[model samples]
Target: MVFLPSLPAHMQRRAPSRRLGVWLWALALCLCLFGEGAPAWAADGEGDITLSSRYWIDASGVQSVDEVAAQPAGTLVEMDGFRSFSLGSSALWMRLDLPRLDPSQRWFLLLSAAAFTNEVDLYQRGADGGWIRQRAGDHLPVAQWDHPDQTPVFAIDAKVQGPVWLRVMNSPTPTSPRLQLLTENSLQTKRYWTFLMVGGYLGFGLLVLFLGWVHARLYGDRAFVAYCFYVAFMLGFQAAFTGIGGLFFWDQSARWNDMAPAVFMLWLTASGIWFVREVCAVSRHHRGVDRFVIAWSVFGLLYPLLYVNLQTPAAFAVLNLYGLLSVLLSVALCLWTWRLGEAYSGWLVLGFLPVHLGYPFPALRSAGVLPDSWAMQYAVLIGSAIEIPLLLYILHRRAKDFNENRARLRALESTDPLTGLTIPLVLTLRLRDALRRSRRYGHRCGMVLVELANHAEIVDREGREAGDRALVVAASRLSAVVRDVDTVCRVSDTRFAMLIEGPQRPEQLKLLAQHVVARGLERVPTLPVELTLRFRLVSATLPESGDSSEAANDDERLMERLHRALDRLASEPRRVVLHLPVRMPAGA
Candidate 1:
């Protein structure tokens, strides 16, 4: 019976419950450290002032400022807070009643959700009592805005004042107007923080994307490739949704500017599903679920074309529904694959848990169930910041495990199971390479063929188990006697081969032969003391090839000669070592 050593208390495996506690603690610490803080100006209450606002819905979407002002008092409705309107060919007109302020102090009205508005036209009465119109929104370039910024900012005129009229036209998505009236100092503070936060997230995302790309190229893994695509589209979606794309990129193209968020969201969802499918290897286990995932991902990719053309509320609703389904599908796949014994799938689940938890906020916000808030805006961003790097690390670990398993398989195929030496195929391949090098470099290399001459007699007298032990002992002794550069191979049940690569003389070969014979004849502790191993060794220096044809069959010819010499040694009872003379080719 084999006795296994007991592991130390510290080295012993812990219960499954304790396995992930460290990771959980680390995640909690990260969340606490990177938690989002409320805007400094807003928290201080010194930069912004709250103003009462009323709104009128223009169903025709053709109402001028004068026409909106002429409406009956009862026609306008008081807004308690921000309100979201469904996408349609209607315009929302807001009337903001200004408060008396010092003329010297400059103030601006900030629309926190300006990124979602398609067209924002602010009408202010000039000193001359004439209406001055200023335009800002996704439909207009950020550079051309009255106050160029990430979101629309319109100057508040303290002098002219009965009321300021603002018209908002939404694109193919829900529009939620979150207006904040701020002083110049407060606006600058907000801008600074906005830039820092958004810029940091983007920079981190780009770094993760680049790392995923590098791993993709290094491992040639489709999962890493899919991850790169997922990250790229996710960044695009965030940039477009947050108005960063409109402010810096594609700002001049009004058509693309309006459609970017929707298009990127659709593509992001599709690519994320594609990434999950590859990472989980979903198709290999659950074919039906895999098919559904594929179909859903394709639908997400192509639905944007129809959405851009239709631009209907139904199309927008479909997009939101698809997003919700994609989240659920991804989670389900990871869980299913994990259950099916894919360890990486477990990491995928853990890596995306933050995203999964954060998704509901944005999904509800899109569906108009949740009001626009900081959670709705930055929850996904924070989650992605955590998820992206974790996923990349998971992929790295997966690739490493894959390569190690492949190497182990190769080792198993090439090495002997019992003796732990190279098998015949490996020996033959190495011998061929050695012969090729000997021919080209004009070096002398030798092969020593060792046969356990009493292997059958030992089995008959001592038993089959003793014979195996004897072979193991002989293999260990031969390996210990050879140099590190030489290869020891178990060629057959009782025979072994060694390839000694070198520029060597016959004297060295003779010495190596004697050492091999002497070591093999040594007593094995596992065998009986009375029994001794009989070893026959045939050593020969490989001859150089004369032509390409002879070179092709050089290893085979050398192997045949060695076996024949071993047979010849068997006939000579007194001889334990036979040294074959090196034969030169005709031309050489």
Candidate 2:
């Protein structure tokens, strides 16, 4: 502290205790009248003033101006950075001194912390050396507001510039508030930028939400659906609770401005819980916990309606408590899911941690338990916005993996693993469909039973592995030669069948059989030791071999006739095919 000049040598040396008391009284008077935050001193001088930079705070719960003024100056503390100070259920007295301004100039004091404060009082010194008062607050009617916008702006008579004292009181909590001094034109610019910011945030949220909705449409997945609800709830709660809705959409709705946060928060909690349930696959994996989550989520949606008109301190406290508890439960759920081996739960955990960890910051800052900072105010927004895209990407990856895996599973059931041929089940179904089509359309559908005549001999001679390899090669060769419309499958280890449908007459069928025989000879069978795979390819028209006794279905009849044909082929000299009535080689 800068001190006054020392007393003269004789005056200082005499009556030490009396001198000490006199000096102390003088110091006390000086601090009271000219201390850093003394209203008599102008806190700001010159061009433009950011009133938050200079403030004197009294966390005194006193509401009367006279009472607060009577308090000793030592009780008031100077603010260091922002006009932010937390005093629960009390008022903060702030003083801003502006240097003299010419009569031609005008100034506006902008109060941007409208959402957090319920009432604010502005007092400016008049020519008569007395403070003149003006009132502004959210609780007041729109007509009573000092300015015509979402946030409050009070006009300053620059010609009467000196010092101004504002009594900020009756907020939900103690907070360091934001205040800006500007010319009328600058205030307009600030409003414009604020408008753009709010609009941009909402726009970006909607675009992502549309993407989530698209995902739900394409895949019909519960996670995507839940995510859409989650984002909606989050965005709604942010809009209402942050007072953006009042500024942009509901400025005239005083009741809505008051109740919007609690009401929207109710839905937000429920949606967040439900989203956790779906994204974490809680119902499928954690049956016991799932019931609790569902019950709580359902209750949360209805709880706000139950207490719709209940606006008390206790009510607000209870709602905040429930919100915090919900976050804890969700956090725990994520941790449990992560621990239980859900790999994607890592994304869920990190995605949700910000809201959980950040909830307290806003609560603390609002209640004057902590000072407001950008980090505390926007932590959840930054975190959740980041999580939205990352989580969606994770969901996309999961869905893709799910579809690919399902296809592989179906393949396993329908194909011959050893030779990569369609198995009996699939082939049977295809044949039945072919028969139905043939009967309806009166079109010819041919069944070709191509039997590996020397397959057993080769298996016994060259070992089963070689025989299997030869069957694989034969299946590949046959499949390659057939048109895409044809179906090929192995009914037995050594015998295969092909369903051929198209514009093919009897002569054309003969040519197709010959082509198959030629192709089958392309790769020598494994037993030829040099591979000995040899086959007589026979073709039969559908329903031609339907003379059946015990077979209950057309599919069975086809298989039965093919087996009988194979038996005939096995008994023959392997020179001619019985159905085709043709010979292949001169040597045999």
lDDT winner: 1
- Per-residue lDDT of model 1, residues 279-354, tens digit only: 9998999789889889988998999899989977788888888888888788878877866767677667667776
**Residue-wise C-alpha lDDT for candidate 2, range 204-284, written one tens digit per residue:** 889989999998898878888888988888887777655577766777777666566667778888888898888777887
What's model 2's lDDT at 445? 74
Candidate 1 collision pairs: none
- What stretches of model 1 exceed 4 Å from their correct place? 1-38, 42-51, 70-76, 286-289, 410-420, 429-444, 451-485, 513-536, 541-588
Each prediction's TM-score versus the true structure: 0.81, 0.74
Worst 10 contiguous positions by lDDT, candidate 1:
1-10
lDDT of each: 0.79, 0.66
Candidate 2 regions exceeding 4 Å error are: 1-77, 80-89, 101-106, 125-136, 141-144, 298-325, 353-360, 404-443, 452-477, 514-536, 542-558, 572-588
